[model samples]
Target: MTNALTFFEPTRTAGLERLRNFAPDAGRHYGERRNYLGTAKNPGAVSALSPYLRTGLVSQSEVLRTVLDQHSAKDADRYIAEVLWRSYWQGWLALRPSVWDAYQADLKRLHNAVQTQSGLRQRWENACLGQTGIAPFDAWANELAHSGYLHNHARMWFASIWVHTLELPWQLGADFFLRHLLDGCPASNTLGWKWVAGIQTIGKPYLATQENIEKFTEGRFAKVPGLATQAAPIPAPPHPDRMPLWNTGQPDPALHSGLILHEDNLNPTHVLDAAGPIAGHVTVMATADQTPWQMAPHVQAFRGQAAQNMQNLLADRIGPAGPAVTSALALKQWAQDHGFAQLVTADAPVGPTKALFDAYDRLPDAPPLVRMRAPLDADAWPLATAGFFKFRKHIPALLARLS
Candidate 1:
């Protein structure tokens, strides 16, 4: 377990292969060993299919269906819930996108504070540089910076320590993850940090203790001292009112169409089917917009390579890809260059990709950009009106639809 975790190849083929290899252990074996962090060489039973899942490289339903084929839902329930947790977070945030808005606002203020305030800047710098003198925390910080992946259990522990012991702003900690983790998404990363800080559940905060860390990590971090002894909830406003979930947008088949690809949904089979034959496709990356600070090299490389791989995959259907762009203006140029009457893509959830499209929407007389949400997302997202416990009630129904 001493080895830093190794990342898998950033491609759909690599993702499916990982799923196939992990399928056998997706039931009791996974549930039993899932919490243990066994490093790169040793590796635990967890799937590590997140980078793939984070994008649309491999899907929730597809991952779940593969596991269910090998094991019954009764046995694989834990792993099943793990996969759907992403969907649950996305749904919760989509229902109340203002949560993301507020988080962004907080980050803007904090980002400037770090730049202008010396004491705050030093503390934050030490934490991000993995020089905090807390052995385990420093190791994890470096690991996240180097490898674009982390164990879910480790992330919870890290977030807890970041908010409680360090007493740093939770939004800043979330930004750190967004700047690094390949699986970083607006909902999961932000909501997760909030949950650790006790804001999401409102009064129930996750705290990291030396005893818990030592036990879960198999003494890899034994006697890790100087963690927060108590966790007090971070004060926050009430949850935003639930807005109606967005339905899948139907693309007009009669129009000359083009496809747009982003890190949000690279392998956009569903969108392509909806748009009919695309005259061309263009890949756009917005990972840079996800964080205020410079992103980690690993995050950029992983997402960039994955987008290119998917574009190569759909090249036959969508034709050669235009030069990948990062801004709304370039996106408009793609539409104008091809002179397609319409452009369509997979609906980006609330995050950087959405921000790019939001900017695009402001441009004068731009071609209509139809975004198609997946049947799985459109079905399951609305059900997250309450807590995950409430959402679990709909799993069987959702799985039934997947079949």
Candidate 2:
């Protein structure tokens, strides 16, 4: 892939333009050739709209609506399914948030393991640095490190190698991608690695064979060797019982409130429409809260700048805009000092931003927090009670509602 910085602009304007340009291809063309891996300069038939979609710059509903305007639902079935896969992953994690907690605990344990186990540390470093003897795996590691993006097919192949072939801990592999990928999200990245490891689906592990890689890469990579042929399911506890979805609260029109913007949802048009006026505005940077270790410099820089970009976009609506704050305490104090009765923000799904809000809500003397979820999420999340196939049965009806 080419330099990620060159392709992704990390702004709402850039995201919408990219969506417009890609709308025409979100049909048969996408279904036919989306799997072929092309160089970063070309990127094959894929939309490459993930960085924007991941941050809610261009929402899933907006993307689907734009594509449906150009093509029928049947024609765009594959493309639409791919987009909703993100929603499925999110809703799945939201209900079973314990999985995320377990991942964090496991990551801390492995981090300590790397400190004491010299050989393990060296092997982990080599895989991350793309120095492992496997040619295709090494190339992908280099591509990810350089571009901060990878073809979806390539991500699966890389994860398979990391888990089954290289025999490295899956959490470390997930962390490596989270540190670099411009589109990385907690729910998707964590569950995706779990899915590849056969834990998410329970015994349906995805193995990347040499033949499949050679075929998918269109002969760019052939003669690869030393891949694991068979995969056994990773041991894991059964899925936790589903929790009731949280209800989005409306901003009280009578109370003085402050609108808070974060990377999870840059466009707060719905929130502005719901809340009559704002007393003050603040932006929170929660990228640091995504992981215990320091986030990659590029990841930190992108999120901070994205929040700034959002502030500039909503300047007219944001009265008394303040600088970005990083902690839950800082956010609580900011709201209190601004004399806000309630703090309103776009409801972040299960991720780092949500984690931050969870902390803020627990703080004593914290201002009331009003989290307003988007109409799309409100409609789609509840349907994800089971696997994607079961949830997928409702796509046509969901698309009809959007119309």
Candidate 3:
């Protein structure tokens, strides 16, 4: 019943193969067709490396460098911006972490409203089930549910419809995407929905017109009826001011250390090289913690298998790494088993995995978890203090640093 298996191969080799195959078209060809909504089986202009990039099977530096090798930055401008957008979102969330905290609180408050209000509950259920009778929106809802993905344009249209046309709570829509999307991250999914509703950029909500949908979809659902023509901004407090980024934690080589490998960064060659020899390693997965509802089975299976792939691929360097655990308590127990002095790991951005570690750091018996951040992130995240346009101005400099 799952197309996720065939759609994405869940291996580094597969990702590299995709990148090389798509590099030839990384120029003007990409910009021309990037917004076209083709079937999931045919990734029109997109690279389809998102699932890989999401799990760090392929790094941004690798992808960007490969594309730049094939074409100049001016030629691949749109494609380059698309790649950097992921980092921009990650950095934006990292700097203003309170945004994540506020989102968590909204979900809690909204869940109670969903439970108590029957009329609202029915509308939300119908929307999730794709039974709202809006052709394009329903198709997108079904597509996301069945495929664990949607074209970037489709996501924007779907969110705009969900918030404006359907008049549903944007938090629920974001949660639905998070539960299903294989490549979903807190920064992109949450803030993206907010932007559509005008919370992220105040009073500038994105609207999904029927004509625009028909155009991007190549006339799939012509004359689609009842899409929202105008979108009003959702009221919200301004986002928190920017905070200082954390310096990369240096894993003390002399101490008895074990690497805590997680879903955040599976192929952390930089971390392993920097962390020195490890006593052992244990794995942790926070996928199930993304929502109170059951996660899509494919989402769970993909990451579980991806972790297995990493363990096998880097077996020599990641010595004794396996036996994945799900919670912070289990991590504490693993530390007890080895009585390690320190735990080295990839620095998690603002997500469920980070939330788990936030809990771990508070544990009375918890050992120090040295979060090794990539130099790329350390260098780029600081520049994300302002809006994306300001961040965009530094693209040339960022690309230069990659070399």
TM-score of 3: 0.97
As a whole number from 0 to 100, the lDDT of residue 323 in candidate 1 is 85
The full ranking of all candidates by lDDT, starting with the best, is: 3, 1, 2
- Computed on alpha carbons, the lDDT of every model, listed in order, comes to 0.86, 0.85, 0.86
lDDT (Cα, tens digit) per residue for candidate 3, span 67-97: 9999999999999998988888889999999
Taking the tens digit of each residue's C-alpha lDDT, what string does model 2 give over 109-196?
9989998999999999999989998999999999888777889999999999999988888899999999888788888999999999
Tell me each candidate's TM-score.
Answer: 0.96, 0.97, 0.97
**Which tens-of-lDDT digit does each residue in 214-311 have in candidate 1?**
88898989977789988866789999899986544789988899888888788888887777788888888887876678887777777788888887
Which stretches of model 3 miss by more than 4 angstroms? Answer: none
Checking candidate 1 for backbone clashes, the offending pairs are: none
Error of 1 at 224 (Å): 1.5
- Model 2 pairs whose backbones collide: 1-40, 2-40
